[model samples]
Target: MPLRQTIARYFSDHAETNDSHTDPLLQTHYYKITADKGVTILESLFRNDPLYDIHASSSDRGEISATITERKKAFIVATVTMVKPLQTAIDFSVTTESFLRFDLGFSHKVIQRLYAHTDKELPLVKNIEQQPAHR
Candidate 1:
């Protein structure tokens, strides 16, 4: 990567999940569960965690918004979508609160840890149609 890009990544205060993200860590995660179940799993994750404060959640919309009130202050949104009866996709967007331009990849690390915990709660489903980038 170019120095500028590296610097931006290290300093960026925002991170989100994307299907074709250049960074594999930000790739969208699919799980083998229903959207409702996915939402329930995520809701419990925030409700049970002392560090997180769930601001709002909607099962109809399949969305959960929370704030990291401890350790590091940040806002996060988790989106759950049902692709099939038993297949669901979960995406997370995190933005850290700070006066500085970046948090040294703190937001990135938060997403990674969230994914790790989620992976344990629900089975991960690999992409069925992963296509290589054109050279």
Candidate 2:
């Protein structure tokens, strides 16, 4: 099963509480890349894609915020942190503007798509196996 489906199932099985304060789901994924490169790639992706509207970005700070309008408006904030010379962490926070408080795994789908796009755009370091998420 897809990660998003798995997460949704887990939440459903556990009877996870949904509160107004926590309506926006936050997800973090680590990628193998420098912070600078990560920010550049994200900027390019967001700027080039018609689906995303860039709200704010600071390459120096390694952060990008954008908004996407599908059935609902989704606000996305992505941050890149350098953990090592070539290891970086990417965090994505997605909030949807909806009448209902819960997203029913919409945020997870956004994160999964973003992560897949990043992986496709950026090539891995030569002879280095991709590492799993750190923490």
Candidate 3:
């Protein structure tokens, strides 16, 4: 990890999944599922969890936003996109309520946990590992 990222992990209150993120765990995840199904699965997960209080969701846009009201306070948004018929992408953004914009990487941890939960409910299409190398 770079110095700046390490600093941000401990000193910042926000974290998000991006295509270019250095950490693969923090990168966008693809699964073999439809966008609507992905949205339903995630919404169900959040609704079932007592810690999560779902506030808004749009199946057409494939977005589900929720807030964590127990143990800590944090807002999270999960975006699902259909790249193809059965290929879907999921990404997360989390911001925690803390003083001095400090959550000790709480936002990052929350995203990781959410991903883990979602992963259990779907099959993730592995990224490019089996492709033949070309010179």
Q: By lDDT, who's the top model here?
A: 1
What's the TM-score of each model vs. the native? 0.91, 0.69, 0.93
- 86-113: candidate 1 lDDT, tens digit per residue: 8899999999998986889889999999
Evaluation by TM-score, superior candidate among 2 and 3: 3
* Candidates sorted on TM-score, descending: 3, 1, 2
lDDT string for model 2 (15-82, tens) is 12111212233234456788998999999989888889999999888889998865757888888888
Candidate 2 stretches with Cα past 4 Å from truth are 1-27, 123-135
Could you tell me which 10 consecutive residues in candidate 2 have the lowest summed lDDT? 13-22
Which pairs, if any, clash in model 3? none
Q: Which of 2 and 3 is the better model by lDDT?
A: 3
- Give the Å error, residue 41, model 2: 0.5
* Cand. 2 Cα-lDDT: 0.68
lDDT of 3 at 35: 97
Per-residue lDDT over 50-127 for candidate 3, one digit per residue giving the tens place of the 0 to 100 score: 999999999999999999998879999999999888989899999998877789989989989998998999998865
Candidate 3 residue 62 C-alpha distance from true site, Å: 0.6
Error of 3 at 53 (Å): 0.4
Count of steric clashes across candidates, in order: 0, 0, 0
